[model samples]
Target: MNFDKTELSDEELSRYSRQILLSDINYDGQLKLAQSHAVIFGLGGLGSPVSLYLAAAGVGKLTLVDFDSVDDSNLQRQIVHREANIGQAKVDSAKQNLQALNRHIQIATLNHSLDEAELLTLMESADIAIDCTDNFSSRFAINQACLQAKKPLVSGAAIRWEGQLTTYDFRQDNSPCYACLYKPGSHQELTCSQNGVLSPIVGMVGSMQSLEAVKALLGLPTLMGKLMILDGYTLQIRTLNLKKDTHCPVCQAQS
Candidate 1:
């Protein structure tokens, strides 16, 4: 793992000048990001910003998973797709957008649903996993896979101006899993399709998710054991401290 200085061409230096100006993520951090890989589930609202930022930030590889195609309804929040990509697969559209943003990175598109086996394969090479999916099934599946693989997971959700974020790192014995906060089959949850979401709300949360992902990949301290809730209507931010549940189905069996 010799992370020597990556020789940035003149064009790359000019392209990433803004990031290079930052003390926290100078040439070294940029090189680290360029060597990292991230898996993003869902190419919807949250996925849009998450993918965009990660690509622009110089992540080496990005694996995008989505089974849906773009439709007129998704334009309200899924910014990655446009009228030209209306009928194209979401993964395809996202890959195009990400490449256009930064062609230096590698973008892998998974135009299908993720099952346990598929997830395990993705996790094998992923440095971090991000849950941008709107459904509980996908989110829970990602959480379980992250736990099993001992990887860090950044989970985010938004619906009608309400957004929430949480990080689960199973490397720690007492860190909570996604199931600790939202139990499986506990209750029916509404998706963006059922309850509309504001376009920028998802952008805000998704960008935050990207930030957390970079932090996790860089081995920096992150919001790993906390739940951040944002109320767009009220413009208020709340942080809830979280703990691993001893009886949580996901964490319990592992412990």
Candidate 2:
């Protein structure tokens, strides 16, 4: 999906008037967002808000990827899917909802997983990639692809009253990849299904992912080299500086 127009239409200007009012994101910023493309993986809890806000915020193009079908259990946190879409593929459901939210944006859907090569090809035109995946394996794969592609990636995870958010802006020489923080197959993988997640926790993290994606596109400050940890139980947030892992196989090779 490509949006070639460099200017925002009157309708788009009105639709995103509030966002454009911000000094950091004036008309020029809104125009930039209107011409940007975002690729989102995993249309689940985090994806729900990320896609919704991006669409409503007037990102020109979006690529939604998810292979799972909507289940009854998903209605609680996956706000993008409705009860009627229970048996439908998540990407299809998300596309329907996102299109309905902002008809001006162009949206594409991929109802299957992508290999590293495929991921790189898909991200060729993407301004940013958002990782809403819950599993560590998917995170590791996405990180590697983004690193190779040299595209910015916004990564988020939430489970059991805890949430984490970060960005791996692979375009920068000093940006750290996800592998720098967690070694593959070393930390136990946790899922929302296995350990209950507070519905709002995902919403919070997903919303932040949307923010970071837009910031990255506009060349604004973001969590590019920082990790944010949220404790829903204590309602506390912590931000940690991330250093490039001198020994990280994934990023060290690129460096």
Cα error, residue 177 of model 2, in Å, equals 0.4
lDDT digits (tens) for residues 1-255 of candidate 2: 245687888898889999999999999889889888999999999999999999988889999989999999999999999999999999999998888899998999998889888988988878899999988888888888888889999999999899999988888999989999999889988888989999999999999999999999999989977999999999999999999998999887777
lDDT value, candidate 2, whole model: 0.92
lDDT of 1 by residue, 44-160 (tens): 999999999999888888999899999999998888888899999999999988898898888988987778987987797688899998878888889888888888999998989
Model 2: ten consecutive residues of lowest lDDT: 1-10
- Model 1 bad stretches (over 4 Å): 1-7
Clashes of 2: 0
What's the lDDT for residue 118 in model 2? 90
Q: What 10-residue stretch in candidate 1 is worst by lDDT?
A: 1-10
| Backbone Cα, N, C clashes tallied per candidate | 0, 0
Alpha-carbon lDDT, every model: 0.87, 0.92
TM-score on alpha carbons, each prediction: 0.94, 0.98
Model 1: how far is 91 from its true place, Å?
Answer: 0.5
Superposing all C-alpha atoms, what RMSD in Å does each candidate have to the true structure?
1.9, 1.1
